[model samples]
Target chain A: MSESRNVSIRVPVLARVEGEGALDLVIEQGDIKELRLRIFEPPRFFEKFLEGRHYAEVPDFVARICGICPVAYQVTAAQALETLFEIDIGPWARAMRRVFYCGEWIQSHSLHIHLLAAPDFFGCGNAIELAQIAPEEVRRGLRLQALGNELMELFGARSVHPVGVRVGGFHAAPPPERIHAMREKLAAALPEAEALVRWTAGIALPPDAQEFVSVALRHPVDYAIEHGEIAASDGLLIEAAAYPEHFVEHHEPHSTALFSSYQGRPYLVGPLARLNLNRDRLPDDVQALLAETGFALPSGNVFQSMLARAVEILLALREALRLLADYHAPASPWVDATPRAGVAVGGTEAPRGLLWHRYEIDTDGLVRNARIVPPTAQNQARIEADLRLSLLNFGLDHADDALRLHCEKVIRNYDPCISCATHFLRLNVSR
Target chain B: MSANASVRPRVAVHKFSSCDGCQLAFLNLGEDLLTLASRVDLVHFAEAGPLDADAEVDVAFVEGSVSTPEDLERIQRIRARSRVLVAIGACAVSGGIQGLRNGADSASWVARIYDHPEAIASLEHSTPIATHVAVDFELWGCPVTGTQVLGVVNALLLGVSPRDNADKVCTECKRQGYPCVLVARGIPCMGPVTRAGCGALCPGLGRDCYGCFGPAESANTDALSAQFARLGLDTQAIARRFQSINSQAPMFRQAADKARAAGNE
Candidate 1:
């Protein structure tokens, strides 16, 4: 076959992207023409359901949006609602919440790196196959994931969509013994997390580079996870409250999910954006480890997104330990929450990237309007843009399987939570 | 269990209109996921691996609700391929939190929310798997826990009927030595009628149960509603309490309707 022969490749289903989505690609004369990363997960109508519901129900309501990162939903919702209430539960509550978020990062990142992304790296079909060759390493990764789940269960009664988080603070605070027990488990899991960073760093990453805006939360006191000012690599800084004013969610004819852009351009979020924006926030030892790994910083290669995730895992584990070190139960688990009519915004860095929530509340504490822009939807356009560049860079002359696998690799690098991403998709392609 | 020890029974996990939380219950198994994989021919599960939609399996774990034209057809195919079908969460057994739309004006809801309602194709109702196909077993939770998932998988491996606790949440609350938030703090709790799989999680944390696990077998929802009214909860407040998480379930749906009706009267 001629290298320049036109080819049409269709992946009926793309796995490990969180939910149901497809990829349709068409190439003419070895030059990529149309690539639609179609996300067809059924629209669950969450925003519509939120109308007329009490602000108190918002946390649990959003938590059901994505299973893997329910805390991201719960935390983001709580923060946004509390802003409307004008209530801050003090230092103890804030620290506990951060640790809780670290738990989410640890588990979510661990699942992606080991179960989803690792299989792709080793050319294995899935985690079951990956476990066969690297049993000990996979077991270690599982332990790290469990430790993260343990941290979540410690605060919330059970890990999956835990109901223990209320609007103001935790529904209940674990006693000193429970916290100490978790500390011991987390302490043991730290080395495994560091090993994961080194493991991911050692994997051979695809070579590609391109200029795109990188946006993430920037914190002066620490690595931004829960609260910070939103900053983009293009020198765009805005308060979390002003998120909607600066960014516009585009409704392209190609898809249903609202893909947001900054000033009419697709921007990047998640681990790469976070690390590039706040690599300095990492601990001195972690900084030294990054230097040892020989991965360059502020690079435009979207393939290096996994490396960004590895870096965050290390940061999450260290932060979890640091926050839990001097833990004391809050005098009260939650503070008084008296709802007043207000509109507010909350933004946090989920395992994948920036998760932003906006809400308008009525005088009765009922949610008048709610808008959730999860990380996956924000990266939809960026992923499509990368698809064309990635395929062209990899040389479309490669076999169909090779081209398809590389395309899947680039999407996996984003660690998309499709359940969270399924805001819209219909294909416009012929193969 | 089959006498042929060498033969691994085929198992598959399927999704419909869900948040992927229930299937996450299986992935959240951590190390146990690998163990479960060893014992079964893990054929299909999108969240955990590649999609093998046509693969025939001995058991199918169905999550989410039937809320689209595509979901209706897909559930039929999944049912045909499996010897035993189990509904894995409130979404699969009842219509999940999204099931809140079952009683409302779905068309107006879609139009008011979605920017391009024409682009979205969803069924008028989101109902449990049992409404479409026979469910051999049911495991109920807003998002079923890892332990409960493991328990069901083990039962399949051992050739025994899986243990599903059908008792009310109050039984577990009493066993856990947690004080009743309803009696002690005047909080509106659904523990009296909500199912028990969650270990009475909310009440233990000094919060009221919001009934994510759905109603228990022969649930005394009417009695609980009367108690809430006696405890000074207005009919509207009581209606919202029953009308959540598993709102589409018969017991809860009726309870919520009666509460609203009483308020109007």
Candidate 2:
């Protein structure tokens, strides 16, 4: 056992994630020598592409960033421009936006749980193999995912890169009849969402407690899906406008994504982070369901992220049902907002985590400058930090395949949207 | 046909430089997605956890555009390994929204977005996969619908050539009985020149189409641009309508150039 072993491991392409990346790890003398989560997803230069475009085009334009969470980009951009132009958007549209976002959460989380992450815990190569063993669970996950997509299409024309959101509000309202049909579907899925929580909680998750700061948007009276002030587990609370003062994204040589740090420290931002900071904000029934699982709030173990995603699905389903029970078509789906010259900033909770957007609009209604900080970019440093700790905990002396699988498991737990992150790995290990 | 062959036809899904939306069209198929595994050997779809990039296959459905040197090399390798390569979405057919960077100073944009632009590696212009490799077919859309994708797969399974439609979006819009936004509301719509695939989604939603599907066959871009001008759009706006997601398409590129030159007049 005292003998030293040297090996080089290269995961040329990290699979089952949102976008393309590879992982590189180097071990020497049975000790960790070098570990780098190389994110080579080609930079699309989205912020630069936003310059000189009209404010009206941003919602649809930004939706191209990530297919998995297109609603996040659209909603955050609309919120920024609407906040800048001083448009109210009214209560009806406000409540509908939350329901729209809930659809994204349900679909994205369900896709991750069944298609991406669940297979890892079961020692299956892919969901297809997992399906052979657990057909009912896989089918249930797909049903929930389809239902979520349907909710999105109710307002959006389609789920992937949906095109319904505009600056002031939506382009068109769903007729009351359509809303009625959707309400029935949401009510019917309640029992299924509850079962998802119980099923995920019952899965055996690995045990590794590590220290990290959790960052998310926190609303005063709600779970804060679409709007909120920026809050962190370290007691840092600030208006979305003040986010730049605390958070600084720096360029790294290996990644196209800018590695974001909160006060020069790697922090967490995702389902686990959101639940950790806002567990009390859940409704009474959801709180009771979560309590039944016996899973403690503010969990430090990253493997518990699966449970958090499942719990949030139930929370989103209930939230959507409550908002849509009294649905009515508005006289005007959107209002015209006169363009103004000023800096616009807004933050919203994407399924992955907090997504922030900033824009400078001119009196001519053109975007003068733009910047977007997606969740995966914020979690880059945190993911790298976790890889080092989790690998060492799992024992570096293990086989390369075992170590590589462990690395992918940890990364996928964050549901890193590399497609969104170029705005956010190949694994190579040398010993 | 491989349908009757002893070996199941192996299929691979490849990614390049764009959003994951087009490939997501496959996963978003939901129930059909599970059944798809039973029909073919999905040997190399990275997002779904199978990662054999070099696996030779009967069909390869590629998403995104070739935007970097790495993308340039990978697409060729995919074309070599694939028997029938189908380019899906605007990015693979034209150059996607990132193609907006084409004909501009890409280095400047990189500098604007990053602190040290020297570290970033990308091509001067994002180009379609067809620019580098021969594409057997093209499914044009910002993101192709699940039905369109399933249709192609089913055709391949039946040992027949998949069909391509080159009709304009206006045809689909008229067929759906949606009021014409251009004539009735004076909204500048791209339906007259944009390809038909999205089933007139924007027009059905009471908004104008933005030409996400690129140019249809023999699209009259000059007429569309002239119509846009009559709708009170300026030369700049007229140019931008053709220059959005499908800016890299030859017809749209020419329209954008002509409109921009007219602004000088």
Candidate 3:
């Protein structure tokens, strides 16, 4: 007969993580029993409400899904609509999209690194607490974050739900003077970003390398931030159009957000996955910085995601600098786009991972059906798996500490945005 | 208290019924965060860090709107815990995009969105935080700008009041020298009544203002509604303009109600 005991780990409030979520683990006689990452974030039925809205309103509407990465939603929605219409947004527009996305990367990655991930490395509850211990590091992280915000504000008009992003292109192209003013600050920020990358790389990652099906966009040239074909480390190459063919989302009873899988398997996305699959595609400067920091490709240690985020910051700084230096304002900010009645799919790399949006539009451009798969929803299963593995090795006597650390590690691995997860904690021990 | 002790104020970022975007703004601070952290202790931010729920705080940045019984209770608790509680974003200052259901039949909205409405529990109307608790200050936007967020933080830390100009978007549009879309192109623009902080974003984009920044102080919503009607906008269309992202905001709400009433007449 197996001895069984119920262990409930409640985190009154999960620290150093975005939004709220709680972990409930039931272990009986050391044999793994039940693990549930309960996501209690009230369901905001975006898909339901999307029906009957105009296609032109999608980018603006879906952008509200996540405040941190609204551009990802806006860009992906625009791309999908453009594809459906067979509209070509010229090179300048595409380049501008890339530039705009780089701003998102800088902003999102810096937020994840300094505020969300740093406290774990230093054993602090949050960044505010960490400030007392490491003020300079926090300051540097904020400055880098600020520069990213500045970039977004320059191009998008507002960082949160940017006004400039439209289906065809921006409402207005930034004037030369605004672009010029940002150049010097961006150039100055490059080294600070490089320093941050090194600092992140130096942190001691938790000892483990579980095999993960790393998924990200792979571009033939340049790092994939905005748009590209979906590629996995396990030799799966597919077009963005084929995403639905291979991947599936299941409605789990515990979460408002659906859990996703690839061919019945959990896959990893986000910075680490991108770094692993497209390391060579990175700009030479970023590649060299990674090499100098000894950041190996396909780093399976999820904790190193923070490091990967920092590296992306470096890449963003370099790219922003280059884009600014070679800046030529487009004559027209947008192309005329007329919506056609059809079903469309759009995929773009959100700050955390690949964000996909699909919409079915009527002849009048009214949305008939909408399906959005956020990065956090896709990452939920992998997080549970990691938590299971991490806990398998933990001693039961240290259950509380072990469970807490393991949960934090799992959360960190995916850089899970519980708020984005459709997304907190309390401890209950039953003997 | 020592001079330095008085100088370095404690800061707390709180969440209500929101997407956590406004609080994410703090994390989005990145490198500047280190400097800001040194200036103030971020005491209780559930999204950014783990802190005791009941911890006393100096300055609270509250995000989201009051949408449920829990939200009402939580906001009250937060108000009691903090010395100064500043509501951030549209959800806090005015009900956000989700507030569009206000003045409509809540039961119909619930039926339209949920497969099992009985499984869920929520208030009939989504309201701003100030409806439940006294808000010391408010920063408006769907998701507020990082600059405005930083401005408030810096001002609070320095013991000075944050400056939020209660002007309409028309001021910014005039300053930017953009041609009037309403007059030139016959678009139904809300620039005359919408708040200024978003820098006339929609107008800059060659679109009429959708009023994401909410209505300005003492906004002439009545005149704007009349102008929109004169521009060939039907009552339903005019109602929709006021019924968008900042639907529950007083100025916009009243205008939308009037438009709906006109439609019935």
10 residues in a row with least lDDT, candidate 3 chain A: A422-431
Best-to-worst ranking by TM-score: 2, 1, 3
True-contact fraction per candidate equals 0.72, 0.75, 0.58
C-alpha displacement of B117 in model 3, angstroms?
7.0
DockQ of 1: 0.57
- Candidate 1: residue A35 Cα off by (Å): 0.4
Best by lDDT: 2
DockQ of 2: 0.58
Measured with C-alpha atoms, the lDDT of residue A171 in candidate 1 is 86
Candidates in order have lDDT scores of 0.84, 0.89, 0.78
The better candidate by DockQ, 2 or 3, is 2
**Cα deviation in Å at residue A372, candidate 1?**
0.9
lDDT per residue as tens, model 2, A278-345: 99999988888888998898988999999999999999988999999878889999888888999999
Could you estimate the TM-score for every candidate?
Answer: 0.96, 0.97, 0.89
**Residue by residue across B75-121, what tens digits does model 2's lDDT show?**
98999999999899988999889998887898866776666678788
**Inter-residue clash pairs, candidate 1:** A256-A424, A257-A424, A270-A353, B1-B159
Candidate 1: global Cα-lDDT?
Answer: 0.84
Cα lDDT of model 1 by residue, B1-265, tens digit:
3234348888888888888888877777777788778778788887778578788888999988988888888899999999989899988999888888776787876565456778767888889999998999999998888888888888987899999899999999999999989999988899999899888889988899999999998888888999999989888878888888898989999999999999999
Best by DockQ: 2
